[model samples]
Target: MARMVFCRKFQQEMEGLDVPPMPGAKGQELFDSVSKQAWQEWLNHQTMLINEKHLNMMDLTARAYLNEQRDKFFAGDAIDSVEGYVPPSE
Candidate 1:
């Protein structure tokens, strides 16, 4: 049987992740509060930001920026968007 959590993002009970997506307290918080679906959504948005910004993960500053954005996103803050990015039309 799948684990269920009261997903903070979806505001409903849904399938939870198999494990914490990260280490430490934040990861525990997510494991406790965020649903797998919501985490996947954040991942998609994160990918867009990385691609559009040409973020270099090797650079500490870039990593820090991404981390900050991730936290803000999960916390429902207005995170910055990829500048000049236009979604493909179906």
Candidate 2:
């Protein structure tokens, strides 16, 4: 299913679905509950991988662009030391 597709019952068509246990819901309370649960689960699984992939792709693209531009920039894998240090005395 598409990431943006909400399994929500209140979509434009309404699908003529009668909301079960209807109360407190604009159209159907049961639709609200079921849709919420399904969408939540869907979002949890889908969002994680898509977000991770986006971050990974962005980092790779940035590194590639930087590499093509200059070899004098910060080292790709170097650890930068923390400065302004004041160690607590024993």
Candidate 3:
């Protein structure tokens, strides 16, 4: 059976990640509180932000912006949307 955690983002118990998503305290915090589904969603959103904004991952400012956005995302705060982008129809 998969591990369960009280997902901080969704505010309910959900399937947890098998391991930390990254190293250090932040990763451990996520492992303890973030659901796998939420993590995946964040990754998708992050990718869109990278592509649409043309952010350079190697740039410190770009990385910092992403980190801030990530925090806001998990906290349920309003985040910037990809300008001129639309979702696909079913």
Ranking by TM-score: 3, 1, 2
Residue pairs with backbone atoms closer than 3 Å in model 1 (clashes): none
Candidate 1 lDDT, 1-90, residue by residue in tens:
999999887789999999999999989999999889999999999999889999998999998998999888877888998899888999
| Tens digits of per-residue lDDT for model 2, 1-62 | 31132333334322222334235542353343334444344334334434443435367774
Model 2: weakest 10-residue lDDT segment is 71-80
TM-score for all models, in order of appearance: 0.87, 0.22, 0.97
Once fitted onto the true fold, the runs of candidate 3 whose alpha carbons sit more than 4 angstroms away are none
- The prediction achieving the highest lDDT against the true structure is 3
Instruction: Tell me the alpha-carbon RMSD of every candidate.
Output: 1.4, 19.4, 0.6
Is candidate 1 or 3 superior in lDDT? 3
Total backbone collisions for each predicted model: 0, 0, 0
C-alpha lDDT (0 to 100) for residue 32 of candidate 1: 96
Model 3, span 1-90: residue lDDT tens: 999999989999999999999999999998999999999999999999999999999999999999999999999999989887899989
